[model samples]
Target: MTKIIFKEHDGKEHPVDVENGMTVMEAAIKNMIPGIDADCGGACACATCHVYVDPAWVDKVGKPESMEEDMLDFAFDVRENSRLSCQIKVTDALDGLIVTTPEKQF
Candidate 1:
């Protein structure tokens, strides 16, 4: 399993072990990590699951695709490291991935 760390805007952190191939949003919901609503599931249909991937892990996590980028336009406080958690797939390479959620999902 891969371990992913979800950090809330308020500095709270939730660490979870997730199987490979699962999306970050899935891990968050399954582990009850607050702040990631994932209103559209993992379909990348909404920006409710927006997160800011830690700079250190950005390369491993990679950039979002065009579709995801478009959806991210609706996320709050978007930055260079901003991404839709649902667009990030968990993998062994992402074992220690860290992502921070926005103050509000909308």
Candidate 2:
């Protein structure tokens, strides 16, 4: 399992162990982590799962592709590091990955 840490806008931290092949959004939902509504499931059709990848892991997490980039336009407070959690696959390389949730999902 790869451990990932999610930091909420309020500064709350939720660390979870996610299985390989699972998306960050899946881990958040499974662990009941607040701030990730994931209304579109993992389809990348919505931005409810938007998150800011911590600078330390940004290169590893990479940038959102066309579909995800388009959906991010609807996310609140989008930033250069903003990413749809559903687009991030969990792998050993992502262990200790950190991401921050926006104040609201909108």
Candidate 3:
């Protein structure tokens, strides 16, 4: 399992142990991390699970794929660090990944 830190808009943080290969959104939902609406259930068809990858971990987490980038066009307050949690798969290299939710999902 990989450990991921999810920070809510209000600055609350939730640390979760997620199985390898599972999408970050799945872990958030399972752990009841607030701010991850996951309206499309990790389908990459919606942006409700939008998050800002911690700048320090951006290189490790990598950028969003084209499909995710397209969907992110609909997210709120998108920035250089913006990403759809559903598109980020867990891996041993990603242990201790950190992501922060937007003030609201779109």
Candidate 4:
């Protein structure tokens, strides 16, 4: 299982065990992490699951695709490290991935 750490805007941290092949958004929603609204349910149509991938793990998490990039443009609090969690697939190499939720979702 991969260990996913979700840091909220209020500075609260939540860690969850996620299986490989599942998307970051799926893990968050399954674990009840509050920040991810997942309004489109991983269809890449909504940006409510927007998050900032920790800089240290950027290389590991890799870059987003053109489609995900387009959706992120609609997200609140966009950042250099911003990503749509639904676009990230978990892997054994990403066992200790850390993601921070944006302050708001719209």
Candidate 5:
């Protein structure tokens, strides 16, 4: 399992154990982390699962695809490290992944 740290805008942090092959959004929602709404599940149709990957882990998390990039544009407080959690698949290599929740998700 990978240890994913979800940091909220309010500075609250939620650490969750995510299984390999699961998407970051799925892990957050399953663990009841208060950030990613995942309104469209993991279909990549919604921007509610938007998150800012920790700068230190940016290279490790890699870049999002064109479709994910388009969805991120509609998210709030998007930054250089912005990513759609639903598009990020978990793996052993990303065991200590850290992601930050956006301030808003509408």
Candidate 6:
């Protein structure tokens, strides 16, 4: 399992152990992390699972794919590091990944 951190808009931190091959959004939903609505259920069809990859981990997480990028156009508060949590698969290399939720999910 990989240890990932989800920081809420209010500055709350939720640390969770995510299984290999699981998406980041799956971990947040399983752990009850707030701000990750995941309305599309990791389908990459919606932006409710939007998150800003911690700047320090951006390189490791890499950029969002074209489809994910297209969906992100509907996200709130998009940033250079903004990504759809559903698009980020957990891996051993991302054991310490950190992501921050936006002020709003819509």
Query: Between 1 and 2, whose TM-score is larger?
Result: 2
Best by lDDT: 2
lDDT of 5 at 59: 96
Cα displacement (angstroms), candidate 4, residue 48, comes to 0.5
lDDT value for candidate 3? 0.94
The better candidate by lDDT, 4 or 6, is 4
TM-score for each of the candidates: 0.97, 0.98, 0.97, 0.97, 0.97, 0.97
Cα deviation in Å at residue 30, candidate 2? Answer: 0.2
Report lDDT (Cα) of residue 14, candidate 1.
90
For model 6, state the Cα shift of residue 106 in Å: 1.7
- Tens digit of per-residue lDDT, candidate 4, span 2-71: 9999999887999999999999999999999999999999999999999999999999999989999899
Per-residue CA lDDT of candidate 6, range 1-106, in tens? 8999999988889999999999999999999998999987889999999999999999999998899889989999999999999999999999989999999977
Tens-place lDDT digits, model 3, residues 1-106: 8999999988889999999999999999999999999998999999999999999999998987889899999999999999999999899999999999999996
Candidate with the greatest TM-score versus the true structure: 2
Runs of candidate 3 with Cα error greater than 4 angstroms are: none
- Per-candidate count of clashing residue pairs (backbone under 3 Å): 0, 0, 0, 0, 0, 0
Give the clashing pairs for model 1: none
Candidate 2 TM-score, true structure as reference: 0.98
Per-residue lDDT tens digits for candidate 1, residues 37-68, read 99998888989999999999999989899999
Compose the digit string of candidate 5's lDDT tens values, residues 1-106: 8999999998899989999999999999999889789999999898999999999999999998999988887888888999999999999989989899988896
Candidate 2 deviation (Cα RMSD): 0.5
* Model 2 C-alpha lDDT versus the unseen true structure: 0.95
Instruction: Give, for candidate 6, the lowest lDDT window spanning 10 residues.
Output: 34-43
Better of 2 and 4 by lDDT: 2
lDDT over C-alpha atoms for residue 93 of model 5:
88
